[model samples]
Target: MRTIALHTQTSEQIGLVLENNDVIEYVSTRPEVRTLSGSIYLGKVSHINKAIQAAFIDIGEERTGFLKKESVPWAQTSIEGTLKEGQSITVQVTKEPSGTKGAQLSADITVPGFFVIYQPYGKRTAVSKRVDAEQAEELKTWTSQQLGKDEGVIVRTAASKVSTQTILNEINQLRDLWTRHIKANTTDRSHKLFDDPILPDQLIRKHPLPLIKEIVVNNSKLGQWIKQRYPILAEKVKWVKSVSTYTGISINELQSKLIQPVVVTEQGMELVIERTEAMTVIDINSHKFKQKSLSSYQKLEMNKAAAAEVAKQIQLRNISGIIFVDFISMQEKKQEKDLQKYMSGLVRKDPVSTTILGITRLGLMEITRHRRFSNVSEELSAKQKPTFSKDTLIYRLERYLTENTQSEAVLVAISSDLYNHKKQLLSNSISSKIPQELFVRHDASIIDWQIELEGSLDMIQTVISERVYHVDNLF
Candidate 1:
């Protein structure tokens, strides 16, 4: 069982509540700030790079916003010809800027709430994927009647069991908000027209229902806002004086736990997640329970348990991209099938799309999940510098050059901080390994390096073959 506590703060007061480790809620006295996630802006195109197929927009920021050609509303117009420099166009931000990448913008705009998603550009009504056929049809019909043909809306998963009155209230609120934004747009050209508010309902809309037991907020105003918008959830809401008091833990302790290494266990097996990456690799090892007396069937059961745990880990960590799971091999085909079945069931619970390919010939299971935001490891390592040393970079470069035999080669060193370090080592390492006969000049400003070997095509092929072989051996 899990308990939830809520904490809120006004200009003068703070409140908190604590349930179990599973649930805690808090609020702040800070004024509500707008997030760019779903806000629509009329931006002016500042620059366009046809080579990169990207454009920069002046969205009232120091750095111009970025909009890739694909992200533009292609259905609306032929963007290649329609978009021009200094032209004003309606756009929405999909992702905030991080690092050197500018904020990601889209011509398509969507305002998602707990019970419905409002699409300013859409003409047809759609239903959430979680809703059943009956509820979807009914909701679609009701939304059409209430909203008319002026705008489009997608009924959310939370509306699965909601009443018509609740749906109507949401529609009215959204319509009013949209109207206000439209009015503001006519008068304001250099400021935000409609930035999304950080409301409790907005948070609940973003997360999956099964994972969120409850929400707790400390501010009476926020608490009232939640209860007014989601009367059904009012009973589950708890208010407290402060977030720290609500969680029964200090802010520092909460941060530590959130940032700590995650440990997963199932049956007699355990796996520790020290770090995560675009390609998450899980190394599995048997823990205790060596079956000397038991049959092969008993051993197979442990492998199945491990597979199940891997699936759970993927969801809990919100891991995506190429995942390599090294599972304990079972000789029997039946055992492998059972493990696969168990893994499939776990994947079904995940909100993100997932595909579980069976074990590779190399005895590795490959799983892929769709990625939206950065994975758990990236979020945690935001402050830490990379650990790759100068020695390691040199060793990698030398191995690459020795194994691949080709006419010309390009080595792109991406990171700004590592460019100089990589360039110096690469030039010296290649000169030492292949002798001065190879021409190598280090250019610091060049983001990438191209190696061209002037010789017979066959000789070029030989160099590439050798370099590739050497690089593979180093890894």
Candidate 2:
């Protein structure tokens, strides 16, 4: 069974997709680095690069959006012929802004519903290939009749469970959503038209119902909203005061593991995953395999086991674009073929478009995964590893004082920003974390923060009383 866990933390909202109690995917959203994917915009054509066959558009975002000539579904000519410098057009964001680059936009607009994706400029109606062959053909014919020649609908796997009436209802709702945003011959300035940023609902829509044990969220309002929108989920949607308390999963521990580059498998193999601007690299080392010696077949088995871990890491990290994996070298061509087939089968399980380009001449496995959002590392600021806030430090200090130094209290020297807070606010805020008996003394002498002294409460007080004018006792 699968469970979805949602939590709001210090700087971001986190979502976890757990399969059989293991975290399969980790996603987060931050206010500063928001995603632009699936957002529609009234954009103005800023520049058309005929050489590159692309257009730069001003969509009222921090950076301009890039729309390739091929992305314009309705266009029959070159980008220069199709777009003018001052022309206004409706576009949808297909990718987020990376580094200094702008977001990737597309003219082919698609609005997604639970069971169908409404394509306003799509050429033909279609259904997921995972659907039964006969049913896919039937849905294709039926949906083609429902949608006109210009528009189309891509039926999803979930559509098989619902009645035709429910599918049509979803189709109409998605169509209405597009029709409401797009209008005929309006000269509107460059600005945002619509933002489909409800990630929890989007995730729930993507996963089928039979696999889900329950969708637990910390926020009651969000749980209620999910229940309302997806009545099909029935009692599967639940509201809880604390997700970890109910699910027995520590989100913080999972998040911490996400930031680390090294992953050690139970097979004693380690995967060192590194992300670069150009691509991601995964180097697998089997120096410490539990088996002392391996036969050719045992080597093949090790590579296959590593392949499963690689696939899980790819999804969990949300690593996209080009990826190269350097696995333990296999000497036999037959063994290499077996490993390739095994990895291909594993990548097919990913929801996103992931393809194995087969093994290169250097025995490196080449892979490509395309996605629209920032990766787990980027969202977590794993590279930066910023210092903790004052509140976080206080919480840590309280834990330390309670756990290890129960009889002893410490004198801390913190920066003025932390030490010189408003009088009443400091007492109320800092005092609430520790017991009234445990004491804290602060001074603005140090550059950042440091623990000055630790002793029994009375000894610390005696020292402070000797140097009475030097420090301020916060509690």
Candidate 3:
């Protein structure tokens, strides 16, 4: 059985897709720059380069957005002298900001609905390839008859069973929203006019409702929101006070498993995955079950098993960009072809667009997946790494103390390694600046870059109560 469990923390929300009690997919959204992909922004042209035909747009963010000539909505013949510095333009983010570069923006805007994507600038109707050629032609003809000369619609696969009126209504709603955004963009400069829906709403719009057996939420407010947003799934909605009550595992346990660098398959094979800035590499290792004698058939079976497991891991971890999979060497050409076909079949289950490039001469399989947000490894590295500099640690400590000024006394505990590294601070007179009976202790139990606070029992209880609440009323 497949189930989706939701848990929200601070400004972040997490969703886990479980199949047969095992997590197959994970998603996390936070109020941070990493989650700003696909948003429509009204930007001011900062600079232009005629050599590359690209312009820098200031979208009211810390970094500017990059717009290329090919992504402009204007006619190719009429684009000359159309854009200039100090001009306001409406652009949508096609790729997220990476490294020091700004986001990739496009002038052509497309709004997605439940059954179709509304394109105000487009002139032709398009249908999804998932539908049969005959049915797609029929859909195209129907869309062409219904849409105006300035409007176009791309039929989604979800519209296969939907009524004509319903599809038209959805398209109309999307067109209205797009028009509003465009109008707002023209009036406001360097501001966001429209953004994608929240996580649950996005999931509902993408997946078929019948496939989601249950929608479980840890908070009553969130559960109510889902029920109100998707009335058709009201009967399947569930409210749990804690995520642990719904899923056998807690959020911490699931997160720990997701960060593991090595995964072992049921066939006694192991996969070690490494991620770098340029690409992700997966190495297949069979040393665990290796014996004195091994046949070609046995090796082929192990490789095939690894193929399926790799696909599942890729989806669960949300790894994107160029991926290189190093498989066990096979002597026969037919075996390599067979393995590639099997891997392709497995990757078809992923929702993201993934293209499997043929194997290389060195037996490394190449793949590319489109990415919209930071993957699990990137998030974990930012949140869990313990390498704070001494100055940063002191700044954080001072900030924490300043925030809790009402406390009568405060105790700061840190790992021994950090204490030893900063022992000179004791003589530098920085420790004496702390006021209100502050105590700094070195504890081996704590991590190097982490700071622990101890307050009254009453304060701890209040924090816990505020975190976990009863959602029984949601049902």
Q: How well is each residue in 1-475 modelled by candidate 2, as lDDT tens digits?
A: 8898888534678778889778887777777867678888989999999999999999998899999999999789999989999898889998878899999999888887778888988978889988999999988888888886789788988787778888888777777667764554245678887777746766666577667789888887787877765666759877788888887778778878888999999888999998888999999988786457678988899889899999999999999999999988889999988998999999886767789998999999999998645688767754665687666665565556556534446676666665544342345655445543344455556544566677677888887788773665554
Question: Candidate 1 residues 1-475, lDDT tens each?
Answer: 2343433343322222232473232222224423466667778888888777778888885567898887764434445575898887777888877667667888666766667877665567898867888888988988877765557798887777668887788777777666675434643354566665434443345554434565666767777777775565677666766656655666445444435454456465656554544577886766566555546687677767776667755654557888887777667777777777778777876557788888777777778888643354444345675665766755665666666565333333233444456556555445445422343334456443444455554564476577652221111
Model 3 misplaced stretches (Cα beyond 4 Å): 45-51, 76-80, 84-87, 180-189, 201-210, 219-237, 382-475
Tell me the lDDT of model 1 at 108. Answer: 63
- lDDT leader: 2
lDDT of each: 0.61, 0.79, 0.75
lDDT minimum window of 10 residues, candidate 3? 466-475
Query: Going through the candidates in order, what is the number of backbone clashes in each?
Result: 31, 0, 0
The TM-score of predicted model 2 comes to: 0.72
lDDT of 3 by residue, 1-475 (tens): 5677887744778887787888887878877635566678889989987778888999988799999888886746423366888988888888778789999998877777767888777677899887789988988998888888877788988778778887777776677778764554466558888777547766556555456778788778877877764555678778888777678867677788778989989977889998877999999988876554666776677789999899999988989999999988788888888888988888876767788998998889999998744687678655544576776775676567656656554556666676665554444433345443455555667665343334664554454357542211100
Best by TM-score: 3
- How does each model score on TM-score? 0.64, 0.72, 0.73
Could you tell me which 10 consecutive residues in candidate 1 have the lowest summed lDDT?
10-19
